[model samples]
Target: MNEQISLSAIKNGNINAFEELFRSLYPPLCGYALKILNDSDLAEEIVQEVFYQLWKKKEDLLITSSLNSYLYKAVYNRSLHLVEHKQVENKYANHVLNDNSEIYSIQDAMQAGEIYQIYKKTLSQLPHRCRKIFQMNRDFGLKYNEIAIKLSISVKTVEADMGKALKAFRHSLAEYK
Candidate 1:
């Protein structure tokens, strides 16, 4: 069956057509996602999520392009989102490590007040906007896109601010390591 026919079958709740589409499309979509994500497991998960969403929302979906095009676009977007989320998570982890690393051992670490003082001093060194973005990300656990929307800024701006903040932290906290 052709793409449109299979889609019609899907919209009509035809399980066999859905299965056929899954069998035909899953491999190439997974490969496409893998190229973008560079992790086999994450790529597979993204593709599976695309398929699952497709199945779940089959009724309202409008396939203007070829199903192949739609599926590929979905995979690409999902892969990018996953990469961005991972970047935010890594940045948060680095921030936590830098913020608390003065204590090399249980007995060697500074007192809580001293450590808080160091953290406060390091954070104060950042540019005002950069510090706020870093705080939203690290303290509030917001994703890059969420931070961008909250701040009414672009995602690229959020990323650049995060990079600047991390660089500042690394430069200031080098002594702790």
Candidate 2:
């Protein structure tokens, strides 16, 4: 069940060869995923899914390096994606349920905390003026011109700061996946 032997078989159209590969590598891959996800069942599911996808698309499989590395990377990426999706869904769910509070997030309390921390950290990295404008627009739902008058800066500055803030948020979130 050497990886090279299995990979050769897979590339040559012997799809079942990957069964041994999957059996051998599944645990470590799941372990790597658990480091980020910290959920054993979720980690196992992600690792299983990674293998299922690999087998489903085996015709286009390419192993530039070792198969183990590819499997590990694939599982890691899938786990990260699962976490990120939960965050987005939680954001929508936390919408104002009542006058009490916006109950945002279905993925437990810890994930909500992490998402808030990431948002806070990214906001902190923005230029001070840009951050203020962004908060005014997003938090208070202010119009661009209104924010301009309130901040005593040009409307164009408000627009530009919003743009910068958006770019920073997108860039920071891109790494989360």
Candidate 3:
């Protein structure tokens, strides 16, 4: 199948070899991704990211078997990771909604206040940057780009801090529930 030729050429830093491989596998990869993810757009994203990673990691990449299995496994694992992360976010969002609903009752309101107070207290214990970023997101309603610009940090950093903030919130608020 000349698989060794392609892999060897790519290992020697042949751009043409990588491009050829990408073009040849693009359709089947997207089709496989679609079968796994059930969404055309997501499938395209997964396939694209898979190829990009292959290119980025070309130097240390060692494929003892067919490259197809390696690529397929990488895409599958990435999709599963994405799904698991979404599930966690959804679970926490549902919990926050439930807490908000319970705040309607008078007795629950006092209990909720205590819960919120405890949450605020714990939040204050976070590093200054983390606290500021969390407040900007929850209290100021700023997007990641805005927060990044305001704090002179990268957008990726802002996104990361928001993730950390959510994790901390979930941990601290667990005491209430």
Clashes of each: 0, 2, 0
Worst window of 10 by summed lDDT in candidate 3: 100-109
lDDT tens digits, residue span 1-177, model 1: 787899899988898999988876676666665655567887788889998899899999998987767777787667666666664233343433444333222223222223444566779888899999999999999999999999999999999999998887777666664
Off by over 4 Å in 1: 87-177
- Among all windows of 10 consecutive residues in model 2, the one with the lowest summed lDDT is 97-106
What value does the lDDT take at residue 7 in candidate 3? 85
As a TM-score, model 2 comes out at 0.46
Ordering by TM-score: 1, 3, 2
lDDT tens digits, residues 93-169, model 3? 34433353342233343344346556766788877898899899889999889999999999999888778878887
Report lDDT (CA) for all predictions: 0.73, 0.69, 0.70
TM-score of each: 0.49, 0.46, 0.46
TM-score quality measure for candidate 1: 0.49
Q: Alpha carbon lDDT of residue 173, candidate 3?
A: 88
True-structure RMSD, every candidate: 20.1, 15.8, 20.4
Count backbone clashes in candidate 1: 0
**Which pairs clash inside model 3?**
none
